[model samples]
Target: MAELQDELTATAEMGELAELSSPTEEPPAPPAPPAGDALTRARALLTTHPVADGYCGLPATLRTLPWYDLELGDSSVDTDIPRLRDGGVSALLWTLRLLPGTAHAENPVTAVLEQLDLAKHVVAEYPEGLRLARSASEACDARAYGRIAVLMGPAPAAAIGDSLATLRALHTLGLRVLTLSGASWATEAGLTRFGEEVVREMNRLGVLADLTGASARTARRVLAVTKAPVILTHSGAHALNSHPDNVPDDLLVDLAAAGGVCLVPCSAERTGSALGDVADHLDHVRRVAGPESVGLCGAYDTGAVHPDGLADVSRYPYLIAELVERGWPESDLAQLTWGNVQRVLRETEFAARAAALRRPPSTARIERLDT
Candidate 1:
């Protein structure tokens, strides 16, 4: 991997970009469009910006769960945001959860820290991403509404010396969320006293401890030691799917009690098949953790051939509509769509962590708030 400076050292050409579009930045009005035809209006100007002007083509400029498949390059630096913004994804979380034994062309920590420039750029170029980044809003903005973030990893903390520094660096980048353990088990937090120091540091830094692919013991010990809210970011229900990767109901409840959530998805790790059976795990977490702390996220575009009814990112509105058809309250559906994540991102206390690092923030605060 190449050494990347913290600053978003863009070539001079990129420096001339205009401020992001705002309500005041709209084109002069013409005739009004119909209710469902709003997307047509949005699609008309999807390519307004040069970088985004001719990007991903779809029926309309739309948002989805931002995808995370970055290769180390100049394009990698800023490629995701424009597509994510154009895709209608309000919040973008890069799924750079490194697989085990995948050699890095560069240092992994550098990869994450380099993103700070990216975060700044996203905010600058797409203020909507900044609002989505800051407020974690669910309400759609005409241009954009999503925070651009990176998944902390499938990496174990032991992989990086002074892993606390990585957590601190990520938090500084406004990376408020991270997974507990990833698929490959190289140097994960799981190895270090069940990641006690890592979890403690993550909690202190206001980072989330995701328990997506962890063992029961790893999950429990992490829950026990971590002061930050822990989450099962995405998984199947062990109660139903019974896959090792699926989280057991008991742990699910513990995560909920800790003020965290369980993200159920249609991925094979959770659902065994690519059925995109979001509801199976959603309902499962609902039973285990209750309605408030349960939610959904699909690891789509893996070419993993989705089961019928759930093929692409565009299918999300259908998922929400499904939740509604099941007699679920709109409030709960909102939580599933965006509220729970919003709570996690906004309510998390990174300022204290940063403050503590400057001097010392109370670790006890993490315990108090986490429980």
Candidate 2:
């Protein structure tokens, strides 16, 4: 655990923060706030608003999947709930995937269905602590009642198979977000025609299409066709890290122009540093594509190596403090944390509801396909 703290604190030149204690340490404490008079107010302001990790995971959800194999201990079931509550995280987009090449990879559609069932089961087991959020209003309500709103998303293009109706059915079953493809799907190129159809279906169904794992071509194609705002739920800027998973400056500008948000993640795979690196990615996205275009998608508890100060879900305040100390305005911080994501959700859901009302009653048909 001390080794993890050392890795998190090994910043480039931003000095270091106090060591973050392991989750099992006595009292299960949150990270200490950076020294300053304004930090107290920053922490207060953070708790005042409904804080949302645009993309995160709970220990229970990850533990159910053997592939993760995380040694979360008792914290997996008991302690992490309080950790999130104490950290002021009211809502999160919980990702559930059955990636290709895995044991459950036979039928992508069946895999997604089973995974969705598992997600519901986990949420049901924790009735008081968690609730499924289908719309932005539901997420805010979860915040008002002091419960964590768990919005579910399926990753990559394979999950939907070859049918558009399958996409609609998943949304009907409470899947709110969709990823057209990830980095691995990059080899399957020339998807302009089919990709456009999928994006349109997502708009009609009111699902937010996430482009985190998409190739540049796929991302650009979807952006060109999507009428509603899209979200790069967990990615970084290519200008900063040059990873294929990261979005380039051209796509970043395109994303902002189309009323989308590029949510920056704190994982080492995305950003090579900790809190300071996160701030840099956030600032770069804002600078390249305005403040409204950036947001947070820290994939907590998904088995990714988190940077130092942000080693767990309970350390969100430290990230907020780092941004505040860097002179981010309160309004910008609000947008980064929750406002932008809420706006996208509300708009997307509203459009979906409206489309459903205008459609003919007989149009709802399940197109049969062999998956």
Candidate 3:
């Protein structure tokens, strides 16, 4: 019995020794941090499809502060180079408008020319950060080069006076958009004969007609007359908000059917001052107009209040993050951020080519046509 017990103890000791002699196994690696957070995902999506903000009143803001440099971030304004870059903004259609009560409102054409010059000067001044894009393709190229494309235009056809030659000249000066306000015509009756001719001429010039402030009748008339797809640069869904700047459901339908884009703005006046409110406007537009017909505009630097989460250009990702939390598919968000506007620009260019082939520049003057 004593010998058997000794042999058993020896065997147990041998097993323990063998176990200790074996190589130690590595501890399992710590689990990686979660990458599915809404903000993180939103940032990832933006890296591929950066925001192509349809309307930014930065030019007007810059016009006021001639000595201000955009590179040095300004606390007074919502847009700056740093903020725009942080927001993943790839392109901006900088609106050039001489407000009715402003200093140079009398000679709108010259004032508009000065505004255009300022826009060009800024683009040239910040060659490393901004590139003046005359077309959609140039905007894309600017993105590839890691620069923001600056597209400039003056609002209201009145800025060009009553001459089609001025309109053509503006296009040559890199005016990619021209807003057709109801005030441009001599009368309030929808669009006069001259207005229709202006629309056609704009179609030929490849300038996007913006109907943001146009009356419903005028918007519809422009829609019917324009050969190219128009854009409401900084508008919202009127069904959601009762603001005059918002587009009605019927107009939304017509705009979408015409292959135009309605860029939902993040202004408190047009959309409620909350991230969710802006998202709601986006959802409403997408629901009513289809995803392909919807886009985004910060409407920054316009002296209007902004939503809580979208207070400035840098807040775009947060709004995108909110949409992400709401189960918005990345594909749809891509369209909202960039694809829709790019498509509209491409289609507008195509229409312009077709229009040029169909007819030469109209010699119709407002005097003769309206009489």
For candidate 1, write residues 178-231 as lDDT tens digits: 655542331334434424655666656666666776777677777677655666
Which candidate has the top score in lDDT?
Answer: 3
**Candidate 3 residues 247-361, lDDT tens each?**
9998999998999899999898999978899999999999899999999998888777888888889988899998998888999999999999999889889989999999898
Query: Residue 357 deviation, candidate 3, in Å?
Result: 1.6
- Can you tell me which runs of candidate 1 are displaced by over 4 Å? 1-89, 99-102, 105-107, 110-159, 182-194, 272-276, 301-305, 350-371
Segments of candidate 2 deviating more than 4 angstroms: 1-34, 59-73, 76-79, 99-101, 182-190, 357-371
lDDT of 2 at 260: 93
Which tens-of-lDDT digit does each residue in 1-371 have in candidate 2? 99877776676223422234445446667888656746576678778764678766553355464543122333543225666775677888877665446766667677778778877876777778888888999998988887888888745567776566677788889988887774232334734455666667787788898887787777787777767889988888889998777989988899989889988987887887677888899889999999998988777766667888887777777888787888988898888888998999988887777766765322222232111
Q: State each model's CA lDDT, in order.
A: 0.50, 0.74, 0.87
Candidate 1 residue 156 Cα shift, in angstroms, is 5.5
Give per-residue lDDT, candidate 2, residue 227.
Answer: 71
Compare candidates 1 and 3 on lDDT and give the better one: 3
How far residue 290's Cα lies from its native spot in candidate 1, in Å, is 0.5
lDDT of 2 at 335: 88
